[model samples]
Target chain A: MTGVEGYMYPNEIRLYWSVLIVLYPYITGLVAGAFILASLERIFRVEAVKPTYRLALLTAMAFLLDAPLPLLFHLGHPERAWEMYFTPHKTSAMAMFGYVYLWYLMAVLTFEIWLDYRRDIVLRSQQTKGILRVIYKIMTLGSSNISERALNIDERVGWLVTLIGIPSAFLLHGYVGFIFGSLKSNPWWDSPLMPVVFIFSAMVSGIAAVMLFYMLLTKMRHKTIDMRCVDAIAMYMFYIFIIDFSLEMLDLVHRIYEANESFRSLNFLVHTKLYFSQIILQILIGTITPLVLLFITQVVKLPEIARKRMYTVSGILALIGIFAMRWNVVIGGQLFSKSFLGYTSYKIHLVTREGLLVALGLTMLPLIFLWILLKLLPPWEDEGAHAPAAGD
Target chain B: MNGFKDIEHLFRFAGLFVIAILVFLVVRGFIVPKSFGEYGHYRAAAIPQIAALPLHYAGHQACISCHSDIQAVKSKGMHAGVNCEACHGALEKHVLDPINVVPVKLNTAVLCVRCHAASAAKPKSFPQVNAAEHANGIACETCHNPHSPAIDAGGTK
Candidate 1:
């Protein structure tokens, strides 16, 4: 048997634990974030969030549409991936991803979006032209009017879906953390706190995405910014960060308290490869800075312009920080070999299919989809305004 | 707006009708279990395998009759559960024809990877399927004994 060539054949280093794990967290983050975006109006009853509700749903749906793409692409034989369900006896925590993805896509996200949009589809089908009109017709299933009773039903159904979705969203991303945590082999990921940390960070990332998109789009439209909505989102992001940060510390503390045989190597790896990330980016700028800033704004009531700046900047940082956390978890865990004999390094490639370029492209595809979805179903329309919330 | 309201009501009524149809289909989706005899009826019509006779492995007893010591030697682990006819790929023709049948080559790694693949048992510790560590150089027979796995230890002094 030939040795799995290492540095000489970079592609042959198939199990380095760099990109695959990052992809899992990133996808789950989107699912959690998207659902949180929808929850803004549904759970909290923010009316100014009306413009963003449909957009958020579409964004979530879009990201979720591509959620399984990374997994399929990463599979050795992508074609045989569906064979997972047929043979559940071979089930692992990762195998549960297929079922989770399907439930979210089919039951929660897809159904919720369709129920919300069905009335809109009926209203807009006749007004639109060409392929979009055809799509509207198919989407509406030929209904072209929104009745009061129907709207009420939609609102009830949408609300119910949203409620169901919240737990499923947690399950979706939390399960990824569970996947990492379940692996007792990796000391870095084996903590029980992993799922909570992933879920909270997911909310932070999701809210940040919403703020970023909201700011950019409103700027594009030259529409007055919804300071209330932005501030509300920022506030939530801050709260989640506090929870996320504390949980992270709890994880570290637990690890430190135990200080197993693997501690020295893991500690060195963190101090060296992950020190800048965990200390500076995730801790100071990502968590503490944003927390203080958001806290100050929340308490003292900063001027609108200042609040906007703080929210946008903090949101962007939070997004980056969460991505960093993912990078650390995914790549960090792999740094120390199971043998604990020595440490191996992961060098990220710039151009491979599973490289940075593809990751960037996959991230952008949802944004592009959100743009088109916004155009197709402008949430600001009169019908869109009074559109029934998830779970009427 | 009043006329539009009426049209909206009509659409809602129609929508409810459509949803009712969908609900009916959903509720009706459960498959009723049928008897094996009923299954056999369908299988009898469409299945070609019914006419074929079951292939039997000429007993390992016979092979042991000639090569008793050799069978005893190989019967440690992986080969323990398996009979001589399995890897030899149906030795009926080899026994009867006695002229042209060739025993199949057993590449231990190939056979082991078939079951140990990620699709088989999802090893959470490793990220990739058919882990690169094992896929690299370790032969299946090295770690696992083919005869009787319970009895076969990794070859050691």
Candidate 2:
């Protein structure tokens, strides 16, 4: 590796835009998306999606735990990151992260999860033994009674959290886009449409993840497939993907039309370093192909087997494609020098912590959390087991 | 009764064990070895540190004390406020053996980048230089006095 010694301009004046900035939003996008998927079943009362509702919640929680990890790692002094909350300045865009994260985690997701699982928690608290019992007891936090009134209250609270959560989800990912949009130094990122593109892409990613997870869980367990649930998810995903893909193209069109001074170099960089990701993976493979498949399947009202297969495949492809888009935007944008004089390559080390290895670890950590969450709360249990009969 | 309960617990244990090992290996690989005091000084050994020499501050006083005539000439000239040791770095070695020791070279553009690079906390207060344009053709000390270039040489405020 060649030394960057003296090659860099003065640290104060130069903007050290790095991939870590993009990773921060990428992780948050997963969190917001997963939670929104959970809300579809839990709040919207979509009985078809019941099997995956709890799983989606668990997935959201798992990724949410690590959402701030990339941000901490990227800071020059990670310890000082907490100061954004402790010594917040009103004008600073970064200071608002603490409040946003807290509102989602503490108020929205946590409350929703508790209301959804309160009956299960009360029942399990009685049967579970040893440390696991204690863990559940702590999780339930001294609330063990299960009643008709309590269940009604739980439903009421669930509705409130999910209702508040949609706008919260938009704000969470939208703000991240604002960070890039507001940055006036780089002409490539300076655009007002950035936040809208980010929110729609987040929704697409979220729905795609849920569809893939539900399919994978069924296949792994060798259970009878739930086609109705998959169909509903696919329909929602197809509509969102259409809008998301269009907004992304709109951003690209704006860039092309404006043709600013930085446009030539930015365009060249995209064609060179980001062509495969932006054009092929994101647009064609990730968005269009899956979109077309979903549309055809939904419109035709295809058989159960075909619909499940198509949704699963499309969902997986969409997830991979969206991640590739994030990679292109985050890593690609930084490859060119700010001077616009020359292009420097970023070589990611294979074994290093800040390299691809850490990223893979962060991605997989959520899967492990989801597994544990499933064991704790089997989402497939019939509602009759927890609630009273219809008439009596 | 079947042993489904024990088997489920076993699955959880196995899953956790596998994840723990994966995390350990990744963390171990990325952790940098401790060096350079508590701040764990950057392993930028390719570039030498300026902290070791006496040329930074005290050496400037010595030069001003002994070579008052040249100092006077410099005082009347453009380089007035800049301490003598600022560019010369630590000057003890040069002061001890003035004939043998080489004075620090203020010759290259790299010196400018060392302070001008984006990460720099207190970058020198100057208009941003065009690196591609100014980097190759000139030396930093050629146009401006190293000691107090802003104040002394031709005295432009």
RMSD values for the candidates in order, in angstroms, are 9.3, 10.5
Off by over 4 Å in 2: A1-22, A42-48, A383-392, B1-86, B90-157
Minimal lDDT window, size 10, model 1 chain A: A1-10
User: Candidate 1 falls in which docking quality class?
Assistant: incorrect
Worst 10 residues of 2 chain B by lDDT: B1-10
Number of the top TM-score candidate: 2
lDDT of each residue in A130-223, candidate 2, tens digit only: 9988877876656555656656656776788788988888888888888887888867677888888777788888878877877887788777
Q: What is the C-alpha lDDT of each candidate?
A: 0.71, 0.70
Model 1, range B1-157, lDDT digits (tens) per residue? 6655534533554575578658645543432122313544232433445547665567777667766665666775445656776655567666665557656668866665554556312456532235456557566556545554333254421
The DockQ assigned to candidate 1 is: 0.08
TM-score of model 1 (CA atoms) = 0.70
lDDT of 1 by residue, A121-218 (tens): 77567667899888888877555456676667678877988999999999999998888888887787888889888898898887778778878888
